[model samples]
Target: MADPTSLLPQPNREEDPETPSNNLHHSLDQIIEQSEASFGWNQFLQSILVSLASLFDGTQTFISVYTDATPTWHCTSGTTTCNSSSDICDLSTSDWAWDSISSKTIISDWNLQCSSSFITGLPASSYFMGGVIGGLLLGTLADSSLGRKRLLVISCITMSVAAFATIFSTNVWIYSALRFVSGIGRSCISTCVLVLLMERVGRKWRPRVGIMQFFFFTLGFLSLPAIAYINRANSWRALYLCTSIPAMLYCFLLQFFVKESPRWLFMNGRGEEAIAILKKSALSNPNSEFNSVLLSADLLSQVPESTKSIDPYKSMKDLFAKKWAMKRTLIVMVLGFGIGMVYYGMPLGVGNLGFNIYLSVMFNALLEIPSYPLTLIILEKWSRKLSVLWFCLVSGICGVVCAVVGDKQKVIRIVLELASFFCSRTAWNLISMFTVELFPTCVRNSATSLLRQSYILSAVFSSMLVSVGSSNGFLSYGVFGVAIFVSGFFVAFLPDTRGGTLCDTMDEQERKESMILG
Candidate 1:
């Protein structure tokens, strides 16, 4: 095969060494491509370590499904006024009792069974609201200041600490407040971990490694049913303690093992650290002669002017300053909002499925397993636009069917709901990778986190929908179906980024776009 570096974008070193020419501008993608950074065993190991954060993020986000669930109730003996069909809100408190201890769920402990939907959904809404703020507030920091690895570790710790504190919550108000804090912390983990992992590897391994993050997230989601089942009789506090302690310890692993994204380092004018990471990656690859190439090329000197004026807030500005970037960001944000409604809302609304909640959640989580690998396969053949559009359309149809079927066909209803969630998961997974490819590295973290905020912003409403859906299927599934179906069409406007090299700076990406347009 031809030498890999021979095909990469090369800087014009023949120009005056003192005054670098515009020809000297190069993206980190070009540098890594030119360096022939191999996807070696160490790189694979680092990818796993970084992606593991998603596992905990997934667990923390969904654990509330069990901890906040309204426990089943039964009529007490000799209760002439109450029967199985009687609404608990209409019955006397003494006439019916919870199936499990009050401590098993916050709903029972806080006496929220008869409360309004807004009150019952507050904690979850609080969590997603916190995520929206966190993503907008912390998103630019990763791209401009903290870099990816530090922000990832800090986010993990913030979430764990907030979770640990949740065990002490005395009322629904306290619990909701802490959940909001946890949501803020949890917001940055997936975005930072993903950008960090994608930047660490070469283009050949990017898609495969990117998909690995979601696999870990599925594992986290799957773990919930088993953990909740095991702690069925214990206090809801145990759930918080169980997930938080290990996550806190995981931060240490992240701190010691994970390396910052070299692309972020170079883009922000930290040339030495950027070179060190690149050289380390080169050494890891047995086939690489990248170190010698690095020495000869002096790519760092070609760093763009955008990096020299690195302001943490400027990263956020870049997203809206360009008409193309703003339009692309808004379209994807809308797509994420719809997918988020279904992706998150379904699991939270599983109690309304008329099937056993644990079994329903298990099926939903299990369905996510196939979607990632299927996404991998689909992206290999389909454009990101088509893959997301079609999968979301299928999910929307199934969700509408689930709403229409209702309680009459319990089996079919559950099956269709699971299918909807599966397709939504596929679309959700694809759009994330889609967003990553949509923006340059200069604003990639901000863009990814912004997309997540759109998801979280939708999720804020999803919690209330789930509360209402517990009594009305149309409120939850029907709304989710319509939202996603309408939003899926927006994908047609987004430029397909599959198989394209990642751009390191705004100028580099803008130049590429102009060339294609001109």
Candidate 2:
């Protein structure tokens, strides 16, 4: 009988030093490239299922803005009792008459507007805070025991439950906590889905499929305004019910239909399972002849020696273990955080831009329509680094234009802000795919989540900035412009990953200490 170890493919040092056994990413890529599954229907179905999480996320994002809307009010008699313009200390039912007594939010219903803006903003902020905490807790699970499919399933369920229970939120405290939990679950869903989708397909097609997946997210974003517009005057609960129900259905759909990532299965020493998946993918295509060699179990287990023994938590620790890796992470996060300000904050501030909140959100969402197809094309035609750089440059310039224009120029302000958001959305799409291409699969979740945490962290401040600048464009748009512009230079410092293969470990991605530097 042949020895099991002897059958393992030995790595040739000279020809391909970076390619290793547990680098199941490339192994899966090789398998797909050699088989008909590279662009097969099975993979297409899988991509569609996986990208649903983004749609869930996009809906959750702007729902709060419309749901938590402040009710319009009027002074009953041109009156004597009201003391100040925005009463910071006192707001009573007697002091104002809601324009529509039937339509209201917790803030208006409870008369919490007189409370500090900090208090009014707490629920939204809690959502971002929970996302930060959740990233620390569940982000690494994608790389280890749970894997991407399980983590995404559990996370989506959590989000759906939280969102559904929000229907019962009787007061501010209960509502805030639920939003926090939803944020926690939504962040987990966002992190895992991208990693799962990217791992499921071949490296060559990764850009095309992954960038285009956000189209579903755009659809989700567009849907919210219509949902809200119809019910904005009736009940905010309607918005929650709509988003939560679809997300609930989504969890079941993913759990039953989706398969565990083949790369993840291979990485965990489930060789037979991974090979079986590859064979299934191969046989799923009707146009091509079957190839048995593509499903070789011997090839699936050829990862680096370190990956076999590396602790999953160590993947998180490794981000800062080396000076270069830490530097790479910080730079990426800074870029993400800088642009993340706009990516995460734009929807929140859309109402501030003097447009109807519903139309503004839908208009902002409209930009994503063009951004998606252009991004898909740009990703294929350009360097990942240059794509980010150009996106930043355009977004930053438009943002500054938004700041320079006057309030009297409402059309100009609207156009400039839209253009800025368009570029920011483009940058956002590139950056999302860039993280996958930039890091190894082992720490891919940790790396992307860390950068995302930075985005959330920046969002914490972006929320504050939005509050401080809601009435003033310069404070928000100018800051976003400057940060994005400088981050573009930081983006240039990172490696260009266009047409590069995915690696399993940082050592493989960098290959040398100097590959990334301070």
Candidate 3:
């Protein structure tokens, strides 16, 4: 086989200004410069908007306000107090009235609430349950028919619309329903973006790009508080409205800038279109020699023979055909679920622990910044299995220590929480990369999405656990510790894919096996 890199277009080295190649080179340079500039600016703006979209969910902000209000119930400090005495009640003296009021607004009337009950936590947990279902349904669609770019666009638009609709909800049921829809859209967007980015970039860039996605996701976490501060006085509805605008705008912008995945095009038998895209990509490479047929051959070679005639559903069946793959799927699923439980549970659990919810979440989010760099260093310098094992073990140990501290020593608990945060973030980063590496390209997105649904599902369970553990001191932390410990066991099942090239198809794996034996 010829070197795949050679097939890509190379820059015209002939310096004669009169030559057609040189003229094309100059034009290509201009295009390259423009594309880079546009991509950077657009990504920056989108990052901010994405952060705002998260804030629209208002999980942290709403919990904080509802928890902190001492007098009349208001969504935030800046909210206009209900001037009508009829609307505002001093139900603290009456048990029945207090229960009624607490049901509607627990944060403002915390004295009447049963903190340790599951019912109190049902609203948030319901959203997560919706997220799980959404993830499974939409995630598969994202892997099969929609393609990553289209899935993201559609998810974002629907999420934005659902978010805005949440504002008009009069009761918890309506709010939960809208949140469920939004959760599904959010799950699809998150997974699709990962799939899209990994497919577009070269193998060498995969880990770095994977880390970059989480970095931006963490930025969304960091910015959530600030956005909440700005819209604190406004109705919670305003937050949704704010998030919707950016999502809708981005959907429009994506139509112009985002290209369909060439890999997907080829897999779907749209070979001509895929070839055209490759030609355009080659043309954009100022250092590449233009060769359309050569580029097409290289791209075509990446498509496995099995994939050529296989239906999408059949492709999924093959993913689990081998024992190693089945093991990989199970391990990834369990690990994702455990991590999701810890990650989502911590924020909501901490909120109920009577800490400053915003500050706690921000602190946790900040801890994630170091995770990507640490993962990069470990994956490059150490083994994937070792890195995952170390992170999960250490995180579980920290969780245990935190549980032992019992929130009695505020400073100690905070320090332990931060340490645990770091470990969880690192574990999650490794899991995402590891899962991506475990499957062939044909079923890569599908397998990863299915595995990730476990995470979303666990998130729902964790949220409910938060409501249950709210009143019991040390219960939530204790359970979280156990979850982290179990995650470490699951990590043992994953095969190390460190220092390996991304497998473009199952045929690549077969070839590797044959080469090893020969």
The candidate 1 region of ten consecutive residues with least summed lDDT is 15-24
Off by over 4 Å in 2: 1-28, 36-38, 78-96, 286-290, 294-297, 300-310, 512-518
lDDT tens digits by residue: candidate 3, 1-518: 65443433443435222112222123322222222222233333333333333333333223323333222333222334422333334323322233223423433333424333454555566566766776666665544666667777777777767766766766655666776777777766556666666555444456665666677677656766666566555444555566566666766766666666556665665655655654565554445344534433544554323233345455456668876667788888888877776677676666654567568777887888888899888767787877777777777777677767755687777777778768877888888878887776567777777776787787777766666665563566667767877877877766676754445456655554444345
- Could you tell me the lDDT of residue 437 within candidate 1? 81
- Residue 372, candidate 1: C-alpha displacement in angstroms: 1.2
- What are the lDDT figures for the candidates, one per model? 0.84, 0.75, 0.60
lDDT, residue 471, candidate 2: 66
- Which residue runs does candidate 3 get wrong by more than 4 Å? 1-116, 289-312, 513-518
TM-score of each: 0.94, 0.89, 0.78
Best lDDT among the predictions, by candidate number: 1
Clashes of each: 0, 4, 8
Model 1 C-alpha lDDT per residue in residues 195-292, reported as the tens digit of each score:
88888776667778899889999999999999999999999999998889989999999999888898888777776787787777777676665665
Model 1 ranges off by over 4 Å: 1-27, 34-37, 304-309
Model 1 per-residue lDDT at 99: 90
TM-score-better candidate, 1 vs 3:
1
Sort the predicted structures by lDDT, highest score first. 1, 2, 3
lDDT of 2 by residue, 203-252 (tens): 66777777646787788888988987777677777789888998999888
